[model samples]
Target: MFTKEKEFFSILFEAVSEGVIVVNTQQNIVATNQSAENMFGYNKKELETAPLIQLIPKNYHHNHHTYVNGFMKKNESRQMGVGRDLFGIKKNGDIFPVEVGLNPFTVRGETFVMALVVDITLRKQHQDQIQELNAKLEQKVIERTKELSEAVNKLKEVNAELDDENKKRLKAENKAKEALKKEKELNELKTKFLSLVSHEFKTPLSGILTSAMLLSKYKLEEQQQRRDKHIKTITDKVHYLNNILNDFLSIEKLERGKIQYNPSQFKISKVVNEVIYNANMMLKDGQIINYPENIDNYSIYQDEKIVELALSNLVYNAIKYSSENTVIDIKIKQNLDSTTFIVEDNGIGIPEKDQKNIFKRYYRAENALLTQGTGIGLNIVKSHLENLKGNIYFNSKENQGTTFWFSLPNKYQTKL
Candidate 1:
């Protein structure tokens, strides 16, 4: 009966998936399960009665001995490697992460420890990957915030210079006071812009962070769809943030008179096709871009980049503010000396009260308050067109639709 019982215990020990190792007071591994043998790349004959240090890395031998001695003295059951990383070594001299639980026992007045060991290499890798991702995201946020803060500080310095100039013009007291008032108003507007920037950046960043965290949790092959979803979210948010930064850069350049327009001859069809192709990606469900009819023959002599930017901004805005299944019409008309491009959308239209300030920097219609926009795209477009001797105008009614058209000289003549 005793032999049968011993066999049953051996069978049960071998059945455990986790590696089990039994070490005697002398720190020799007196017994181990099949799992333990396989885990450490050893056989029963080689592992039994072997020094426990053989299964541990050379650097950890001293600490392992000390820990073994302390545990023997306490003679209690507890987990090992608490609050720290633990590792194990294989017979082939390969090191790997591990989790170990120790239980003290005695047979015939001889104390021993039975350690339940688990290989945690995969878990460790996942944890390290998450930490790296988090660090990268934090660094990106820090850099972007620093850039915006520097811009604000530069504005402040400019305002200070203006204040000094106003003070020196004492004879124009009324004008000086008016200038200070305008400065105060401008500062308030800056404050509002900062707040808007924070909100716009924070919302997408939070989404990105959340998606990243969720993406790490899905590791199975069947979870590919979920992973793809989070990846797309990250991609889209990054793109949006990039566009916002571009808008900020454009604003800075326009203010500093740094933009240099280079005109060239290009087919208008090429620009229109490119814009439509990009817009197709951002289209809502059931939405379609109706291509302008017979525009392959049309060509223009203008700054291709500027024209592309303006057209892309208008088309993207039309897609953004419009509903699913709605059509955005791009109508082109060439006249005697000028060509006009019209973007008409049957979406949420601008309020009548907001029409006058539609092209003003940082102004948004009341109905568009909920939309994701910096309200600077139109302003930038308007500035670019006006600088090139072009004009932009729009017609809209609340809840109906908006039609925006801009005219450029057919053959732009460089002022000599």
Candidate 2:
């Protein structure tokens, strides 16, 4: 029966496609399948009882014993040579890449290890071919990525133009026709506003792109200041774009009657500080904001977000219309029924004729038509204020300056 069992083992082992070699505790080859003998360029019975090192590359011989000893102690099955390449030597001394799996077992109180080996030269060659193909395609991949980015930017610009046109068309259709002359004036304004929109978007987008390109050139530690300058330009451009988008959204909400005011008690200083912090980023050379005095103790029981938005529009407008080396003053006056916030700037102000229509939607002053503005911020602010029992008013003189002020009720009583 023992002889029959040994014969059965031999038959099964030899049937395996991979090379198999069994080693004793002394690291001598105890048995080998025909596949192992053929793989190592040896005849039948040639590898029996030979040192396992005879089949390993010469450089690996020094550490082979330690590895076998560790594997024997662990006495488990696992793949050999993880995270590294392994090689085998043939009987004629030809070296080739190989993958190896090891299994430890015991028979008749003797410990032995079985090594399963597979030649991997073909797999290694395939991997090298794939890497070479990737290297050749790298430049094409980069060009394609750049083309995709430019296409996306162009799409954004087209979409913005379309959105502005749609808004204008909708507004014109909704308005009551006072006279044919007024309708003709409205059409002319729409055309001019469309041109302004194009200029406004393209100008900042071009600045952002230029700044971004310049930023990549300033890579050295010593060029940090240059990098920061470009970074600031990008940031300011992005902020301006965001404000325009917010203004559009505000217009849409107002037209749809979807504005919802959520009232909550909040410190007035908190809102003031945020507005000044953001405004500081847009300050011209030698310009400064004169922050309101000692309002840290004041609180407001109204819609904090609306108040902040109204304040931000006024402060931003003051900054935009102001000149270099100027001061913008912000003052807060709290009373029993309402609180008034003031933003005064020494810059281009509304013309006497444009002052009456300043709060009208999409109305830019004749003197300020060339400036970068959407002309909807004040309209949105006024609408929000009146809806919440507040009021907004301003005083201006052409070529002098402007002071815009808005007041909100101390405790808002919902009208909707």
Lowest lDDT block of 10, candidate 1: 1-10
Clash count, candidate 2: 0
Off by over 4 Å in 1: 1-174, 413-416
| Tens-digit per-residue lDDT, 257-290, candidate 2 | 8888899999999999999998897888999999
Candidate lDDT (C-alpha), each:
0.89, 0.88
Candidate 2 lowest-lDDT run of ten: 1-10
lDDT of 1 by residue, 1-416 (tens): 12545686588788899999989988998778988988999998899889999998988877888889999999999999999888999988999999999999877677889999999998999989988988998898898899889988999999998988877766488787899999998997798799889989999999999999999999999999999999999999999999989999998998888888888888888989899999999999877777878777777789888888999998998998999989999988876788788899988999989999999888899999898888899999998898888999999987788899998887774331
TM-score per prediction, in order, is 0.57, 0.53
Which TM-score value belongs to model 1? 0.57
lDDT comparing candidate 2 with the true structure: 0.88
